[model samples]
Target: AALAGQRLDVAAEAASRARALAPNEPDVHFLSGKVALARGDLDSARGHQERALALDPAHSGAMNELGRIRLRRHDTAGAIRHFINAARTTPGEHIYSRNIDVVILRTLSRMIYVFVLVALLMLWVPAVMHVDRFPFAVGFGVLAAGAVASFGLVLLRLPREARGLVRRTLRTRRVATALFVAIGGVAVAFAAVAFVPPSELPQTLPIAILITIAARITATARLRSPVSKNQRPGDRMT
Candidate 1:
């Protein structure tokens, strides 16, 4: 109750009392760790959570809490590792799995941003260098291929279950259609620029830029939306 009320002092005191009363209890330690985390005491939080895991190695709650701590510390890889462990330890817990997906979505969002920037540079650099149309087309085709390959590599690195979840999210009808149209439009626009008269360059380049911008906006919007709308209380990522 105190934790829910944003009363950190009260929560800390109550958590301390609970730990005192049940020194061997993993749940008590987990609660203490949560309270410490609320107070921004990362070391205390980590210590309490580690103690909980020591008492009960299979404590998924402790693992999840440790993941939260790692995330707070900007240790993304460590955070993902803990979240994966928690999810694997308790496969039925949707919250742990959701946490992993959230991280993946954030990573993908950043990747999309980079892709958009590179796409813009790909267009601008060719013009500034007075590169031949064929060379420009070849360069853009390679960039598009590299972007696809990078995204694939990211999916391949995930655990099977997480990879499946990500694939399902991406495969949603709206997202898939938007991406397909945007990518297809950009490719077509660039290819047209390569084949059409130099006078048409002005028209084709703008179309490609617009498509790139649309792709970024669409991807960012989808990623920022909740991965699952059925999140239960206490399941929210910190």
Candidate 2:
């Protein structure tokens, strides 16, 4: 109740009493860890959570709390390990599964930002240098291929369980259609640059820019939509 009310001091007091009464109980330690986390005491939170896990090796709650602590500390990989353990331990828990998606989406968001910057640089540098059309077309084609390969590699590197989820998401009609259009746009842009005269190469820039913008918008929307759906009301603890 105190935790729900945002009263961290009261929650900590209650948690301490519970821990004293049941020192061996994993749930008690989990509660204490949550209270410590609420108070912004990450070290205490981590210690309590570790203690909970030691008491019960299969304690999914402890694993999930530890994941939260890791996330707070900006340890993305550590957090992912903990979350994956939690999900693997309790396969029926949708919350644990959602946590994995949250982390993956966050990583994808960062990748999108980097991809956009690199794509823009690829487009801008050649134009500024007044490179010939054929060379620019070849460079752009290479960039596009590299981007596609990098995205595929990221998916392939995901854990088997997560890889299945991502593959399903990509198979959705909307996402697949968007990807097809984006890829097609890039192919057409390359063809235009390759066949068109050097003076006409500038005309393809706007189409390329539009494709980039569309991709950013589509990716951002897709990333954000799942986050809202994953959030559960009144899920304050773990």
Candidate 3:
């Protein structure tokens, strides 16, 4: 059954028939586990699925089901790992894509909110009160530093070996990268104008525009074409 909530008896019968037809088939065992899961026999479901996975490490279905079970049990990190492995094996399934996307979107949203709040604090805390002699410089310096760090983070590829770290980084930094780039550009522009001679402002504006253009072009190129050397699309596999 495609749906996981289907009748277990029916699924079990089907799995039995399948297993009879192909004894030792990993998929048959996997199907039996799905049936058990539908019947709310989690322990049984896990046993069958684990057996299936033991038979075939790359069994995407077993991996995904294990991921689902782990998620239901509140093992979010472990569940994410299983899901990531399933995605890596199949790389083209809609279910796997959706799972990863859901995880990533939720994590990114939370991180973005926190990063924005922090950015505001960095900009406002010293400048509004004029506590420091170079309050603007201190604030803008922090902004620029954050920007560079955030940009570098986006460019870092997700490590297949470090699934948890990669997942968290990808999930949190996806949209945060773009936002930081914009903020970085503005900060750079302000810094240049503040420091550069008034006569240089005309030249500085063009350079700032050039920087913006370059960043946009870089981002677009990363998106529409094959990955450039040392760079990848935000959502691409590492």
User: What's the TM-score of every candidate structure?
Assistant: 0.73, 0.71, 0.45
Error of 3 at 69 (Å): 1.0
How many steric clashes does model 2 contain? 0
**CA displacement after TM-score superposition, residue 169 of candidate 3 (Å):** 8.6
RMSD of each: 4.1, 4.7, 9.6
lDDT of 3 by residue, 98-156 (tens): 56545444344444444444544543333245344266576667766775576456435
Clash number for model 3? 0
Q: Each model's C-alpha lDDT?
A: 0.77, 0.72, 0.60
| Tens-digit per-residue lDDT, 84-119, candidate 1 | 899899999878977876676666667768767787
Worst 10 residues of 1 by lDDT: 226-235
Cα-based lDDT at residue 140, candidate 1: 81
| Regions more than 4 Å wrong, model 3 | 1-5, 104-238
The positional error of residue 95 in candidate 1, measured at the CA in angstroms, is 1.8
True-structure lDDT of candidate 1: 0.77
lDDT of 2: 0.72
